[model samples]
Target chain A: MSNARRIIVINPNSTPEVTSAMRDALDDRFLCLDIPEGPATIVTDRDVAEAGPRVAALAAAQEAPLAVIVACFSDPGVAETRAAVPCPVIGIQEAGVAAALALAPRFGIIALSELPIARHRVRLERMGMLERLADEVGLSGVSAYAAGHDPAVYDELLAAGRRLIASGAGAIVLGCGGFGPRRAVLQAALGVPIVDPVLAAAGVALSVTGGQR
Target chain B: MSNARRIIVINPNSTPEVTSAMRDALDDRFLCLDIPEGPATIVTDRDVAEAGPRVAALAAAQEAPLAVIVACFSDPGVAETRAAVPCPVIGIQEAGVAAALALAPRFGIIALSELPIARHRVRLERMGMLERLADEVGLSGVSAYAAGHDPAVYDELLAAGRRLIASGAGAIVLGCGGFGPRRAVLQAALGVPIVDPVLAAAGVALSVTGGQR
Candidate 1:
């Protein structure tokens, strides 16, 4: 396959573990790039602001693949990256919500912490989809790092998922990219469609580019 | 390019004018197929019900292209077609709605007539997205046939688009495939995102299959 057909997924944060998890979820369908200079995890507005330029710069420096997926739920620098790159640039947050809308009408989010819930609310508000949102449940203090290594976080997610379902969400979206690996388990337990944003981005990229590789 | 990578867009209704309009909209990106035996237009539940098997059978008999887009906004036989085919099958309504959700929070539909509004409402309700709909405006008496031949139909569509915007729709979806050719004009005039479902289906198909021909 030509390099032009390749899809590049960039993790704005410097977490190799999260990058690896994303790569595993994609199963070698695309190239996965991690920014080693970014914070270990983006948990605050400051972290997101700091990572935005790095993500846009990295995307700008690439050789223009078929599509670029900014693999963060906050969609760090997505607009800037789109301005920087010639190919389509997809934000995982937007892709996840889009995928959820395709499968069902109302969707709920399971976030890593209260910070993302607030951030997500702002993002949804800007998109004019806050009305479509059923509920957003957060793990309170759970960090992506702890969630990845901790099995107990799944229970918390399940509890949150139940609450979202109770609130009338027909589908659930994992609000953080680090929650990618736990998607299948949560979907099975919750008995509803669970959207993994990275996968959703990959799907969108494949559809837009028409590159089967 | 392999034939397997080709995308076939099937118009469930047997309207050559609508099919030609769809082909023009796509600019020959995919193979456009029209069902010779289907109704002239899918307006009523009976028309949709009658077209289902034909669409499914046509889809099933194809040589398994990378993806298939059922070009009708009503998405008559999408599920049956999916069951019959191994590759991805996209419904224009689903694709359009998904694309709309990606760009904006709430979407308004500009339908061919009042008949499709009820059908669309039921479909949206089934998807669990009825609440996300800002409104659906119909060009009361405008048929696909009349819309294609008459430049005057654009006035009705423009009026409907403005009504949707006034009703707080952040985006507008051209509810019929025949409206495909008018997308740019409407978007320019309305100053909001307008989703042409056929193009949306093509985009979704390309993303899912990764086959750019």
Candidate 2:
């Protein structure tokens, strides 16, 4: 059992590499948890649907932390998790989008795959922020596991970022939790504010937790 | 001279009441500075324009703090202040809008007067978030300085909030710094999320300062 001040960051996927990368990107004080029962990567709506309940259950079972961060960019079961917990439950996707909006008028997303783009669109539409999206560009060959291990994916990310800028994005949002560590590098390469969803979630979680860990 | 980790929160208006309200709302760790040369309240474009250079000058004169928060909702001289300082300079309006967007899709403003509504519209348009606005409801007889002392303003705020919700706002943003203390109360009364611009600026400032202050 973690202390009451600990923040639980839940990565809703089975890939340990992705979870490890997220933990590295987050503040050292937080407790990072990954759902072992989830799919290796959430590439489709079916994967999201399947992972949702498991993530929510894990979130509900945790003793009260300062807050809970749903580390996946799709924000698996965030509303359900929030209803089950007394403390704040923030979705990385929501935090990222909010950060991007603060930095720029229009924001574009660099997504891991074509399937997640549709899911991202639905979330934005539900938030009534579809109009603020310049575009969402996906790299077809990327997966959360491969994104950490492969140097080639950076090139794909760069290319997608350029296309998003060309499409009129004033800022860029890395649309996957695995992209957290690459935020500073991508922002420098792209010459725009780049929001990493995991970090954004941590920022919001920390704010809600009264600036404590 | 303040310490390097100190954050300077500037209430551009000259009113001591509004400034005191802002200081109380902010984290105790910050150093709040009030611009005594400006008008009593910034209710119009003329007032914002008048206060801009004074606010910018005050911001420029500060020895580098961790960050600077322009506490006025109109965010007078934010761009100029950012250019003048090496550290981050955040505006309450931008922070409030971002926080509202993070919590909900469509956000409405409870503004002080009709004059600020037009200025707020311009800022929203510049951010390309005009479409995300459900509406900007104003309290005809209210001023920032008066809002704190008058218990009657709460009724007007409630009316404005209900109208904003009727107009399709999923969340409410308090467009004046003086309304900061009433956020939780208003949220409970309105049955929705309420974003207080001053606290929102503090949250963003803390995030930009790497959560140190």
Interface CA RMSD of each prediction in angstroms: 6.6, 3.9
Model 2 CA deviation exceeding 4 Å by range: A1-8, A16-32, A59-68, A79-89, A145-169, A185-191, A205-213, B1-8, B16-32, B57-68, B79-89, B125-135, B145-169, B188-191, B205-213
True contacts kept of each: 0.15, 0.17
User: In model 2, what is chain B's TM-score?
Assistant: 0.95
Candidate 2 per-residue lDDT, tens place, B115-154, comes to: 6788899888876667789899888858787766677888
With candidate 2 superimposed using the best TM-score fit, by how many Å does residue B196's alpha carbon deviate from the native?
1.7
Q: Which candidate should be chosen as best, given lDDT against the real structure?
A: 2
Q: What is each predicted model's overall lDDT from 0 to 1?
A: 0.76, 0.77
> Local error of candidate 2 at B194, Å?
2.2
Candidate 2 chain B lDDT trough over 10 residues, lowest sum: B204-213
TM-score of chain B of each: 0.94, 0.95
Clashing pairs in 2: none
